[model samples]
Target chain A: MKTLNENAQSVGTILLEIGALLMSSGASTNRTRITMERIARGLGYGIELLITQRALMLTIIEKDQQHFFSRLKRISPHGANFRIVSGISHLSWNVMEQDWTIAQISEEVQRLKALPHYPRLVVLGMVGLAGAGFCRIFGGGYIEMTVAFVATVAGLFVRQEATKAKFNPYLCIFFAAFAASLIAGTAEYLKIGTEPDKALATSVLFLVPGIPLINSVTDLMDGNIQNGMVRAMNGLMIAFSIAMGLLSVKMILNF
Target chain B: MIFLEIITKSFWAGIAAMGFAVLFNVPRRAILSIGMLGAVGGLIKFTVMNFDIGIIFASFLGATAIGIISIQMAHMRNSPPLVFSIPSVIPMVPGMFAYKMMLGLIALTSIENTDDYLQSLISTVNNGAKAMFILISLGTGVAIPMLLSRKESIKKSKFNKKKEVTV
Candidate 1:
């Protein structure tokens, strides 16, 4: 009985760990459940997983349906990391096709966890250009686009610095939005651009929580109503944070 | 001249999509494809909207093309389709509409007269509903391929063949 319990506990830890990784990396709830299940089946066990925005509850059972272990893992804050999601999906196929051992799978997970993100400078510059694109698409003139580009780079820098300082995520968003809007608003005040309103609108477009909004709707359609509602609420809260930031800038500049 | 306009607009849209792809930390190999698909999606929407087809329908058409193309790309790229579709469609997201709706609602709340109140309400509702419907269309458009794939699983096909063989 002791050996059986120990064995179940060891495998169950990895299963729950992988599930939490997938969930936090922006796998849709349905895909999270499916991937966890596939990995468990490959290891000759069965699983029942319950995913929530804050935590994941898992049950590991014998192949013949005898319950063995139940565990709950608190997920870290969610971030959109598509590369991790794809890596785990590919890992699942290998588990089935190549019949990987638990040891091999865990090593791969570690490797995935260590995959280097693009340099911070590249992301900031590219996203700044994206802000300029938003301005152009909104019919801003070249000057407005230039203002937006500068504002976005500044805003994103503030956001990263705040996040690094360990502020609340929503507060980071608020500060970023405020910084972006203030620059764009100052440009508007100076009459530096044609259609500065478009610049103001597009300057903070980088922080719109687009991924969460789309994932929320996708989750709802997949019948993961609870996770869907949580994600939608998160998106709304971020949107509201952005609005408050912009409103504060408007009040300060009194434009 | 119109072609030039479309080309420039789409080029920027692709850049925006690639920007988002980096933010999402998509795989390195998929980034270029994500950019090209983003441009194509934007091109279709702009071309369709030029004909007065309307923003909502244009978004649906653009998103559907993204959906179809993302799925085809997924098989070749070995990544989930959503990894491509989500960031690509984001360049088309109607964020400004929502911003307008919020401001309009604030205006409606403080109006001094009934006429102003009605005007505020009209614009607020108009922008809000437009944003809502466009979002729904984009969601449905993107989901169509994944949902449709439900009936095309290999296991289902294999099961049918086995039944036919037995018969």
Candidate 2:
């Protein structure tokens, strides 16, 4: 079993490296769904099962449990390599704490890899958009609109599995713009109302400053001098990206 | 022509709102709901003005409704109240006012419209200030509901304590 021992050791090292890559990928601002799935695959689990597990993990309160899934969530294209490595380290610690043998851990990874995955996330997005359109038709006012929009956004946010798609910034921006255009185009086509300006403004409201605002405000309030400033800067970058997406479209449309 | 303008304008507005929400890392669901709500609110308010209600009152009421909606969202999501409220109300924000002020500043610095400059500058600043006040009032209005809810919670907690002592 010296051979078995060596094989287990090799698997552990490889898994750890993969985990590191995942952590870096996880740092992306949005859509970490793909990276997490890959990480689950690397650990030897099916993609779909991993996503469900990750979702449940998010609903957990313990730092360790939540941290594992958060790292998976970071699979968005914007994630840095270091972040994935950090996440792998976090998971490794969990393994170590559990007193599992290297072979056992490797076996666990292998087991996870064999599960089947379904692409419900994308379907959810399409369905949600369609539902919003329907709501608009029924003369649904602000409340219905808000519910539909929020539900659509929440559905996308939850999918996080899409984050692992080939990491291309230009493509990401395009998708962002495309989503906005669809929302705007649908509402406009339906003649949701005569006030197109207001409707357009409302449709895009989903992209406003949120986490950064909260993080920056909290850090600043708590007197975490350096941390607060850094968070604020990060928040600004996110806003900049959003502006880039909108402005690009606006220029194309001559707005 | 007005119909075309409405569509184009709403499209841009949607892009702006969606972009901002994504940037902020607000949950996608919350963003979608707020975006749609804000758009509807903007449309409804604009339409209602034909009935002769003052613009300020209309704006305040619309914004307040959004605030209340967001608060309900926060409760449903188990997130902080502002998480949903802040982003939800953004579509109705006076971005044009801010844009105009900047444009006026640029014009003053770039050329000599000597006769018209002071008056325009003053007007630009006045408009910007007014917009800022509107935002402040909206923010205050949003906070009042949250604050009142907190006060209610405090009273409930105190009442529970008294009951505990008596028991």
Candidate 3:
């Protein structure tokens, strides 16, 4: 059996890892805090956690002894994987509700952290379908829908490649939008679609910061004003990058 | 014809939402429900717009519908509300307005005559404001239901209650 301090150190490390995963995965501050608290509570200790866009501070008090763990984790916002999030969530809930040992919980966390995301080709296909769907909803003709689908697939492929190359997210989005808009513009120039404008617009819909914007507002509403502002600004910057990318293609085409 | 348009739009919106669900890597089991939520939200927005309501108001109602449904889905599925809500809301994002705003800005810069510049500037501002307002409304609409549900959860959790008392 580990000593109390040893157990505390291990728990703190696991909690910090979980918190970093949550933050990097685009979870709001409240979700991160609540989940960490739940895990600490499950370990028969109470914790005070402070989370920001840059770092996490956790203080756990057990048996009248105070243990402080501070982790410096830069939040590099990335794709959302609800599977890992909900998996960790369920694990924490189970820990709180069941009689699970510390080792078991840690093992589960590791397993969840290692869960693989969907393949790149699958994601690309879905995003292309989504673009086509948006085009149709926005009143694009069948031809325009087809063009949008092809454009979005090409764009998302570029995005995936850029991401795998570890390019900055803004640059990735910019290139992706550039590629998509270029294809859509070519389609328009060829008169392949009656609603080329609609196709062009919808083909880049995948870049919209829908989840981040909502998360920002939810954070603000929940009273994490500073983090909310940071997230909102980040989302706005991404939107600007996407616009810049699309505009570059339009300028080149003089359309 | 109008009703048919709404149906088609909603159907497409559902497909879009499902695609987003897959993009976000939401759990396979929750994809269908998220798609249904997006469809309901899109239907509400389309129907309300047919009544001549402004797009902002239409987006608000649609997002609210999504928010409420997401909360219910979260409870039923034992998952976080964000899992369902985020993808469902993607179908209603104002991507076109943002694009138009950028176009206006580009036009504003390229124009030589003052009159043309001012015209482009006005259009730019209009599109930007509309986009911002729509985004704000979407945020507020989703936040309301989420905030309410969060409060209820806090009240129900005894650990949180004790923590509150201590703090």
Candidate 4:
């Protein structure tokens, strides 16, 4: 019985860590709750979970002995990585299906945590291509698309470097937008693109907080109002920062 | 010509969404599905707009399509709906409207004439409201399908059955 109690506590701690990572990585409140509940159920515990934007609390009652574990980990704002979220989701489902021992679950969680991200250059290339694609969708010709592609590559490089240096997220976005717009605005000055306006607009589309905005609505609809509001505010702030960055470039270029 | 334009635009939107999926580090197998969802959503929005529907309504319809398709993809991929929904909708974000609103706000302070200032103010308000409405519509549209399907998912999952038995 003592051994079981210890195992349960370790599982609780692992769940909390996973919860914190998911929230910080931009998972919706609903996802956080569902994942935690599944892990607790898989561990064969009757658990109560309390979740907020900043903290997670889990309580388990076994044989009238209540075990409570709470962790206060501030969710740092970061880009969404669905790979990690999906990995954790699969892990919990496997736990329930396989009835895995505590040690196996912990090892799996650690492996997911340590999964290496894609190389920086590849990410930069994709961002550039995405920007170019946005330009084309908005009716830009080849010249505008090329300009957008180059500008996005440069801009995302700046953003990546800022992120690596641990700069504030808003600051990182601001710098990226500033860099992207400055480059894109050259289309207007040089009269190279048939649709300079489209080039300028699409170059900065990479900075939009589409995921957070969507997640906020999901949370609000699911009755997690507090978390929804917090996420909504964060999304708005990022949008505001991007606007500021772009406006500065526009002001300087007099475009 | 119009049909060709739609096809080209949808293709670009799909490509853009796939790029975004990569940035989000979506699992390799799911990228194509996400791209297809984005293409369909973008196509729907564009087609709706061609009928003279306002952008807000068009965005709503597009997001609803995305939400529905994402739910289906989630079932097929064995992952959450959000894994498909969020990146797919990236192409439709009202980024231009938001930027224009901010531009108008900044430009407001520089105008010396009262009439010009009022003009900028009106434009700013108009653009700002449009952006806000579009965002709300996107959110509401995505939420509707998810909300409707939640009960079905809960009832079908084996874990929930076990949960009931234990209780």
Candidate 5:
């Protein structure tokens, strides 16, 4: 006989495990949407809204004097069971896909149990260092700025493709270049009292754009609390990756 | 030597900038054009600012010109300006400037010196205001044309609307 608190904790842990599995199994964003819809329906939430980035937001609509809020609260602790990994895949120009596959979805949950996020940090760090070194040898004010600009554009274009070889490298280079250029140049201008290497390391280290942060904040401001918090958390994780990369570089370079 | 270095840097920067712009959803045709324009704008702005041009005025002009050029590129391809403007202008994001201003404010505000505090507050406000102004101006410049185009599109589709009305 577990207490409500213990049940809630178990639910939260399980939901996280499931989400991780879905993410690892490479389950498409459409599956997540369907699962969320089913959950909302099961919870007696009559209103459903889909936002950009395939975010599933549910609104409880009730007629009569029924206490719907109470019902929602009772159901929310178990809502994690409903989160599905889903997104709209753009197959080609003017061709979009929203296919759902539930069997492999569980694999994603299982995959989450065996992976570490630190490798991503290391990879990002290597990319950043390579970008910095290239820019140091070949970049200046305009060059540095353009690298980031181009990278952002690249990221946007290739976002739909899951395969890294298809588009990630070009985008990474662009992102890294602009960040490195700015970090190096600004350090020279501000005279921030630290050694040049240290200044560059700290400055460009956080240049990774917190796209999720901006998106989450906008979603929260628009009153989508659940979706907003999710995005914000994801953004925080990305920010952490950038921090780890920067710290690693600084330590290695002895800056 | 400097010329060679500048060229090499500019080439890589242009490629990287364009690559990013394209990756981020900017149309492929406009990627290099916008990036090169940005590189040129930055170079032009930096050069002009050294000779007493106000930083605000310089940055504003650079961004505006880039915006206009991106819009023109969009028009040439029979596409909307939304795609080009976002990617083309991304190179000029003032994140570093904004961060520095924040850091300066924290340091100054924390110190006991009244004069330092005043200067930090002023710098923070100035940077913030400048950043806001750039965004607003960019928005306004793009929005005006988009609105006009949408209206024109509606007017052209009057026949479809009439058919719907009758149905």
Candidate 6:
């Protein structure tokens, strides 16, 4: 038997949980707010939410009633996983159209979060192919593309290992970039290919922070200045770390 | 000959987008479509650039195509358009320019002479601004399609309201 207070607390906690999941899974602030609001409304509550880069502030009040709960959840850091973003979106629509218990929603959230990633070999192979494709787009020859492929694979392997070891996130990117450019720069040093410099340039691109840069602009345009700036700074810092890695290789190889 | 070139380049572009889609953990069901959309975007950008368009403008055109298509696709799939559009635009990202910008900045630190310094500054600014503008164009282009459709829907709803009033 749940008291009204217990119900209210549960609802508030679920909203916070959903909000945290959205924020940490690369959703824009506006989307997170809208999704949380939609779910809260479906549960007969009104919500006021404030989103920051590292945390969310939320208040849930019962509809046409005085009962309300407020809490804040700190998001560890965002890692982009659009699959979760899409799953939550679909769930929100379902909630809007059909009645769902708090427990059911919690179960679904766990399911979505537990979705498996692509196999490691497949990911590594495909990204390597992407690197070679990038080399081709940049007018590199087959030798250059091959060199880019190998370099990119090696670099990504380093990044994956660093991340698995729970190293700092930016440090992982730096290490990956350093490994990639070092491999590519060797081609430049040995004068092995027609466009080794281009290969070197393109091989480090897997760490470009594409989603963050785009989302930063999207957030800015949507008037989420705080989150936008945070995301922009985040993207720029990652790019800078990559640059630092490349600089290290360039200074070492004079390429 | 040009057709084959476009096909080849766009094919690689699709592969690039697929890789990124996987990287971002876009849903499994949507990966192929994301790749197709990315190839189409590459085709558009490459074709536009052939007509003497700048890279920034070409990329905007490509991104707008992605935005409109992805938004419509979202209705059919019951998911947000961002999931589709973000990876689709990966092929058009200015990664090379960003790398060049970084290289230029590095060169600036080594400052050999006035001429060398100026060259480094120019290279850095040129590549950096180009990268920034390309990214901006892509973001705005993707947004424009959604904005345009919203207005259309509003107008249709207003027209429906008028009909109801007349009845």
How many residue pairs collide in each prediction?
0, 54, 0, 0, 28, 0
lDDT of 6 by residue, B27-91 (tens): 88888888888899999999998889999999999999998777656655556778889988987
How much lDDT does candidate 5 score? Answer: 0.39
lDDT of 5 by residue, A22-67 (tens): 3222222333333334433332233333433332233434433242
Candidate 1 per-residue lDDT over residues B46-103, each given as its tens digit: 9998898999999999999998888667766768677899899999887777666767
Q: What are the candidates' interface root-mean-square deviations? A: 5.0, 11.4, 4.1, 3.7, 10.4, 5.1
Model 1 chain B is weakest, by summed lDDT over 10 consecutive residues, at B158-167
- Error (Å) of candidate 4 at residue A197 is 2.4
Candidate 2's C-alpha runs over 4 A off are A1-255, B1-23, B28-36, B47-57, B150-167
Candidate 3 docks at the CAPRI level of acceptable
lDDT of 2 by residue, A104-141 (tens): 65565454333222335443443344334333433345
Model 5 TM-score, 2 decimals:
0.42
Tens-digit lDDT string for candidate 6 (A154-230): 99999999998999999999999999999999989999987688889889988888888888888998899989999
lDDT of each: 0.83, 0.43, 0.81, 0.80, 0.39, 0.83
Best by DockQ: 4
CAPRI tier of model 2: incorrect
Interface RMSD of 2: 11.4
Give the residue spans of candidate 6 off by over 4 A.
Answer: A1-6, B151-167
lDDT (10s digit) by residue, model 3, range A40-116: 87777778777888688777676556555454545555688788788887878777777567788888988887888
Which of candidates 2 and 5 reaches a greater TM-score? 5
**DockQ for each candidate?**
0.42, 0.06, 0.47, 0.49, 0.09, 0.46
lDDT, candidate 2, residue B96? 36
Model 1 lDDT at residue A187: 93
Candidates ranked by TM-score: 6, 1, 3, 4, 5, 2
Question: What would the per-residue lDDT of candidate 4 be over residues A76-192, giving only the tens digit for each residue?
Answer: 556788888878877877777777667887798788777777787878888788899999988899989999999999988999899999999899999999999899987777877
